[model samples]
Target: MGKSIFISLPVTDLKVSVAFYEALGFRNNPRFTDETAACMVWSEAISFMLLTHDKWRSFTTRPIPPSTSSEVMLALSCDSREAVDAMSQAAAAHGGTVDINPVEDHGFMYTRDLADPDGHDLAAMWMDVSPMPARS
Candidate 1:
């Protein structure tokens, strides 16, 4: 298995994207963050590479999709419902838009989705482990 997962995303404005992720409580990993790209670490095993449009283009010859036409959504899990709400609120305060309605509290789980400054779909979710059925 891989040691970690690095999800690379193209951002129209690197600075704005950095701020957007920061608002969601992600810390910048200096080891991988610089002028060309900002590394947003969600966990020890998960990291998001926010690449400038030009820098991202270098990885592929195909044209990048416009933010409006893209439909990719990145879902991240939180420890509790309050964390989910906190992330959504932070996103809005940092200029990111709430793309979905507030937490759909299903008792065992809660979910909310938001769009970053560059229109990247991001979802914050919380799950109650105690309520889940036991695995056989």
Candidate 2:
């Protein structure tokens, strides 16, 4: 079987977080969702578990980062440059902050950054490795 990745994030508002992720094309997996957390499916191999702050605390003793701080940035691969732009636009329109960093285009790859309502970072990227220039 192929490996799967599950990223768990602490969120202040479960419903709003779920909506923001849905806007970015993730679907809710109710089988693993309840009052404290929602399992958002990005693909067959990638899933996000959004947990309420209280729920998150149970998993660790570490303090949650303040809203102005970032513990990690999640990168998601897109099918094309247009898909990256579309998802970025959707994220902004759905209460997330867009362009936390400037867009980057490297001939063979393009990327844009965004921050969810609670300030978790996300990067939408597209790459065509076949056309990439040879390294020195």
Candidate 3:
């Protein structure tokens, strides 16, 4: 069986969050989506399950983090350095903050950080794995 990951996130505004993810290249799967939740596919193997605050609370009583608090930073691979930059720009235009962390560039890799409207941190990156230099 092929393995896949579904990262579940609690969102304050479902519609806006859906648009934010869509701009970053995720397509909503209406088959698994409704007013309370959305299944955003980033790849065949990677998807995000965005749930409304009430829907999230039904799953757990744990408190949701405030906009400034973060427990994780998700990373996404890009087709090229330019793709990474483009994603960052899209993020900024769609109610996200770009460069939450400083951009990084190695000879064979590039990355830029971003935060969604609800302050979820994500890093867009591209790497030439075959051309990567060995650590000395």
By TM-score, the best candidate is 3
Residue-level lDDT tens digits of model 2 in 1-136:
5999989999999999999999999999999999999999999999999999999999999998987787788999999999999999999998899999999999798999999999999999999999767999
**Whole-model lDDT for model 3 versus the true structure?**
0.94
Shift of residue 22 alpha carbon in model 2, Å? 0.5
Better of 1 and 3 by TM-score: 3
lDDT of 3 at 96: 96
**What shift in Å separates residue 55 of candidate 3 from its native position after superposition?**
0.5
Rank order (by TM-score, best first): 3, 2, 1
- Per-model TM-score, in order, reads 0.90, 0.93, 0.94
Span of ten consecutive residues with least summed lDDT in model 2 = 64-73
- Whole-model lDDT values for every prediction: 0.86, 0.94, 0.94
Candidate 3, 1-136: lDDT as tens digits: 4999999999999999999999999999999999999999999999999999999999999999997887999999999999999999999999999998889999798999999989999999999989756888
lDDT of 2 at 131: 70
Clashing pairs in 2: none
